[model samples]
Target: MTDKSTSAPSSDSVSHRVADTSPESDRGEQPETIHEDRLWCDGGWTARVIKNEDDDGWAVEMIKDGEPEPALVGPWTMGRNKKDPKPLDVSAFNTLVKTASEVLRRHEQQLRAQLHKRVAVDAATGDGQWEITLDIVPDDDEPYALLTAIDAFGEQLAQVQVAASFKLSKASAASWVENGFRRPG
Candidate 1:
């Protein structure tokens, strides 16, 4: 048996029960709470327009998934009368995602090039080529570099320690290879 008396719901209770109760929501579907002015782009990226804290203008921020900070943040276009921000659209969101992804990709490539530099030089043995690699280990206490040489058969020919400041340009690498991979005087 149940009580027959009806009671009014409290304001807090009503607000708590106003959650998204759609079937899609229960099924763990994609997020649907995004307003038309904000978007969750594909590839784990999100773009949002917000009021600029520094001024009375607007700004856009592009954040990647699981990141605490935005990868890209820039000014947003103003609407008519220059008070409101222009609404975000599909075209603009896609473009921002592309640009942000490119920025990340180029940053990674540049870091790789800096930490590990490589050059191919003609082997003085007159048989096969040799590969010269300089790997920089930037330790906080003692930074150093590992200069290595490998023959065509992937056998390590020589390795030595050099200053982390050593620059591995094409001309410098060629000289090293010609000089038998020894520490330059």
Candidate 2:
């Protein structure tokens, strides 16, 4: 005698997703597809040729994965007809990707340097060196900067709040350290 009411569902009875056969299913990114006006899913990047909003000229936008906005947007070359954009090719695609990547890299570096500026200055007490840093906090309501000094021993010498847009120059940092990390009047 069998008691069907007490039996639990077997693994085979539970619904399961079938194995994906697409080549990109394993990489977890969309596969590359090319079109006359758009190129996407190629190496985690996408480039599209669009009509310029400001004029009749064409423009190209290169976007990286998971980003809402394009990383690079600039004028695209026109074709012989002079009204349509030149078709995107492999060599052109590679070049565009490289240039866009460089632009992103440089922009990130510049931003990082701006947000966290640092300078080494002579310690106020002696010949020993101290590192001064100005970290900007761009708060929505009230933005500010934290001027900090660290000794060679990695000890916090002093910290003060200054304007968010404060520029940390070598001379200014030296002067600040000499003045006991106080906000210059």
State every prediction's TM-score relative to the real structure.
0.65, 0.67
Task: List clash counts for every candidate, in order.
Answer: 0, 1
lDDT of 2 by residue, 18-54 (tens): 3445777679656434433334336777888777999
Best by lDDT: 2
**Superposed Cα deviation of residue 106, candidate 1 (Å):** 1.3
Candidate 1's displacement at residue 66, Å, is 3.0
Candidate 2 pairs with clashing backbones: 32-41
Q: In the order shown, what is each candidate's alpha-carbon RMSD?
A: 10.3, 14.9
Q: What residue runs in model 2 are displaced by over 4 Å at the alpha carbon?
A: 1-37, 54-56, 80-82, 153-156, 170-172, 179-185
lDDT per residue as tens, model 1, 1-185: 01113223223221111245678668865334343443434446778777799999888899887779988999999865466666666688788888888888998899888899998888888876889899999899999999998999999999989999999877887788778788965
How far off is model 1, as Cα RMSD?
10.3
